[model samples]
Target: MMKKIIFALLVLVATSASAQNGITNDFRFGQGEDSLRCIETITIVNVNLNNKDYATAYTAWKTIFNEFPVARVDTYTNGVKLLNELIKKESDPAKKSEYVKELMNVYDQQIKYLDKLQEITKSKLSAGNILGKKALSYIQYYNNAPVDTIYSMLAKSVEMEKGQSEYAVTERFMKYSALKYKQDKSHGEQIIEDYLNASIYIVEVLDKYHASIERSEKKYQEEGNPRDSLNAIGYGKMIDASRISKSNIDAYFINSGAASCEDLSKIYAPTLEANKDNIEYLNKVLSVMSMLKCTNEDTYLTAAEYALAIEPTAKAAMGCGYRYYKKGEIDRALEFFDQAIELETSITTKAELCYKVGLIHFSLNNYGKARAYANKALGFNNKYGQPHILIAQCYGAANKWSEDDVMNACTYYLCLDRLDRAKAVDPSSKREADKLIAIYSKHTPKVEDLFMRGYEAGRSVKIGGWINETTKIR
Candidate 1:
């Protein structure tokens, strides 16, 4: 036992001396008593941090921060928490700024030590992820930092991460781009393109995030454990911040006036053919062009043609509908319109699709199908009054229901009934409805003629021969 104690002491003395000489230089923990103290203090700092002892944690955390920059990456991670606490508790603006600046430096140092982290702990850290977090922290703490500085960092981070972007960075990149645009309208051209990329990526990432939450919930259900579910909630909250950011960027882009058809065509048309086989590229062009109401542009037509030839997206289908409709292929256009409407999820958009198809049939003098499509539009969105106007127009333009002029004039009741409904559901349609009412009411049959026809003026009448709607005799 005496020999074993002496051997152990020798090993300890050798270890302390080797550590003093910087055995590997992977980290900056000190030598002898200081090295041991740093280790113990770090462990205790984490314990205090975990137990909500921020004050104690901060005091010990600074020692690791200042002397052990090369220590474990957790040193920097914990430093962030400590610095954040200091910044929050600080009453003096100068002191708060100092802490915030130190926090930013901690991120930089974390990046610096990332390559050395494999020696101590497993770390798959990427510069992209760290820079993204740094940029977000800068935004949060630095008030309005230089747009150019934020933009440069955010752009690199997003380009590096691609689809797996830190969501806030992707969102704020577009947002700051908007601010830059306001400062210099010349920035609008690039911002329009930036909005396209950022919006698509953010949407894709959000879908993945939602899918993760769903999987987590499913796993928790099977296991009867809430741990994964709780983690999912935390993850979802982080992504949810991007949701508001997404909305802000969307509003900014829409109102930027940079999405005019000519400008959109210039941006997208030059590359449409080369990207013809690129389904994702085709869809991007179709989506952005359609969003900016560039349907009349040749870029939209070529993109839709390319995308529809490859794989039909919702916007691609809608664009093809326009293509065929303008080519006088009404049947083909309606087919694509029906496909787009089915693929779309929004009720208002579906209504708009149906009404548009109804107008096409009306233009072709197909009143029966026109009214049919119009009624379908109203079914989708009952508050939509334009379809009602379309149906009224169909009734006014239809052939005589009877050889007797009086009986024929009674069709006016059907037309007027649709007009009234249009005015009732949508007050914005009142002017158009009143104008049609004046034209149709002039053709109304006298009460005596209705009485002679065995139809009371106040009773219900079913119009026959294509216009089969129920209406009261006026």
Candidate 2:
């Protein structure tokens, strides 16, 4: 017995000396009895955890956790898993609540050693990641947490991580932000702020991960690996899942309905002076405002011109176009507008810019050019009702269809046909289309006039000029 006891003491002394020298692994298990105790306890507890023996794991877990708190990140991670299982399984409310609090402490203790763990090991852990997990834990187990509590945690995490933020956390942050807006209309500006920030990074992360998969597939294909097709298909499914999670945030933003063009102009105006020099912030501001169709606002024009001075963007050009257009500089305005169209890539945005330029031409009473630009816009987006509306208006404004009085009267019929087509392709245009239909329906040729002109109800007649159209002369 004496020999065995002395051998144990020597082992403790050696182990303690080794720990003091600095360790590359085994985390913060420390020296002497503490190190041995943690090693043994964690081993036994992890076995129990893996075996679904929570009761045994719980008994041993606390002793090591209290004694050697920083033993490893895995210690805390496993603690959370079993605690969650316990909480989920527990029928008794009071016991379950106590377990939840203990689980909270595990996260807290992990944070205390966060930096130290990274210093000692190759842990890629970050403060933002830690806080994000805690926030998710609150959502999972402590769900009654106040809105501000969850919102604040998520904000810190998102700001810290940016494009590094996990899609799950970003998605949750936007969801809670929408809730915040729903509960109080006063939160609209804040919601818009969060929306812009979160959206920028969410897309970035999606692209990054997508690029990773592509690179991997390309490498495998170049190696002529038989698993190449299977690997790409499998990885593609993962990216698709991420896409769904990231996209939910945008859907939530729309549901919030917080930031419109006019509202954004008001919200961002005061901050422009401070943010003018911040190129990234200014670009984001310009992009957000442009997306909201706030391009016509004075505040938007200012941001556009300011951003242009720092870096020329499509939004900036578009904004400058509106400014010149507002000042009645038609030639300069069209130049900037064309620049905007050429710089933009999205089909929808290009379609909108074309429509805007078409509207500009219509304002100048250049009916043929207006129709030409309107047709250009439709070529970009066939289902775009606004361009169809513009074309119909162009025909009506021209008010000339060959010098025949009967043909001129028949113009209303063709105009009504375009209006009907507009509403058919896009339901959102139905109200405006109906209004035009109501106004022009009264101008159709009377039955006596049609009879005298020898034009049957179902007879198709082609109207020529800038308004070249064929329709039945009903």
Candidate 3:
């Protein structure tokens, strides 16, 4: 046991002496005749690091870090690990802050020396990735770090990588901007700009991931088997990241209070006028304005006009429709709603547009036109319950009935049928449909009233005029 202890002490002394000599000589590989000494120090540092002996690792690590900062990529990579361990083990706040600063420096050095090291060692480390690591570390460890400083680091990282930016980095960029906006309202424009950039990048990443997933699914279906495990795992991770990023961004915007109609108009009004000819900018402004429900504002109208003139889209048409609808220009509103339905390819969106037209007709008391529009909505989406209720309302209106008891009472039967259909088709409208059904069932022709009309229960009757629907006597 004494021999073993003596041997261990001797090895330790030799390692310490070797590290000291390397530091004294400023040994660096490819620098001079001390190449072997640099290699020996690197091995010693790596062995200690691998064994979780960060303290011992730091002895040789510091020598290489100071004397040969550009010796190898691992010189910085392993240095990060060593310093982080030091930070964790440190009990003093000042010392921990120093260690944290050193860790950040290590990342910066890695980026500075990355290209040269890549030339020498063929490493794949990118400047963006290094910036991302530094930014993430600052966010996690340095609570007192300047928000702008951290945001700048993340912004540069995102700019460098764009669609390839890390999900966490993009998410953090938005969150930090939101935090800054809350702290200082003067930074509102900057916050909006950051959110736009982050949203664009996130959407691009999501599109790529969704396309990849679709391709994978297609291949799997064609082959009647699963994709390779690595591809499957990669797609799963990307999809999960996209979902999380989307949710985070959505929630951040919804809760940010900066996206309110008044705030959005204030932020986008000037931007819209300055970039009137920039179609892409106009589209972005329109999207944000519409999302914040600022469609009633002049900024929204200006954006909609510019965007529609540049290139009409379903959304642009819908904006115009709402503008006209608000002005009580029923014909113009219907025209734009029709355009929106034609431009829209999504069945659900088309259904909604048709339903809006139906609402306009219902408000005008044009029962025939309203029913036609409602039927058109149902054709697009048969499960749309609101249209069914609208049609029932059109039939149940006082104008649809007359003073003649039998004819007036018969309208209720048709109204009840429409309401029942609504309840059956749309679970969301069940309660409303039930209430309307109860109110209208009492208005249905009583057995005695049907008898007075020379009719009996279960006899077919055609109630003509606006409501031309045929129903059986109750």
Best by TM-score: 1
Q: Residues 1-474, candidate 1: write the lDDT tens digits.
A: 645643444444333533432235532565666566666677778889999888899888887777766655688778887888778888999988988988889888777767765466765778888899999999999887888888888888887887678777887787778777777888876887788888767766755665676678788888968898897776566445655565666777877665677878887788887888999888878767765667767788878888888876667899998888778887898889889988875555577778888988898889998888898987766656789999888888884776777766777888888889887766657888999999888878888878887988688876676776677886
The C-alpha lDDT values of all candidates are: 0.77, 0.78, 0.75
Root-mean-square deviation of every model: 11.4, 11.2, 12.1
Q: Which stretches of candidate 1 lie over 4 Å from their true place?
A: 1-14, 19-34, 50-56, 118-123, 228-242, 269-284, 307-318, 325-474
Worst 10 residues of 1 by lDDT: 14-23
Q: Which ranges in model 3 have alpha carbons more than 4 Å from their true place?
A: 1-28, 92-94, 120-124, 211-227, 269-275, 290-298, 312-474
TM-score for each prediction?
0.62, 0.61, 0.58
Model 2 ranges off by over 4 Å: 1-14, 17-27, 184-186, 224-235, 269-281, 293-302, 314-474
Candidate 2: C-alpha lDDT:
0.78
- At residue 78, candidate 3 shows an lDDT of 91
Model 2: per-residue Cα lDDT over 152-211, one tens digit each: 899899999997888888888999899888988888878888887777777666566555
| Model 3, span 1-474: residue lDDT tens | 644643443443333324333223333252323444556677789889989998899999987887676666788879888998898899999989888888988888777666566765754778997898899999889788888898789889988988778788889888877877787878777776777777767766755665565567677767756544456557656656665675587567667776677778877787787887888888777666665557788888878777788788877787888788788887897898789889976565577678878888888887788889899988866656789999889888843456686677788877877888886666657888999998988888678767776988778878777677787776
Worst 10 residues of 2 by lDDT: 18-27
* Model 3 TM-score, 2 decimals: 0.58
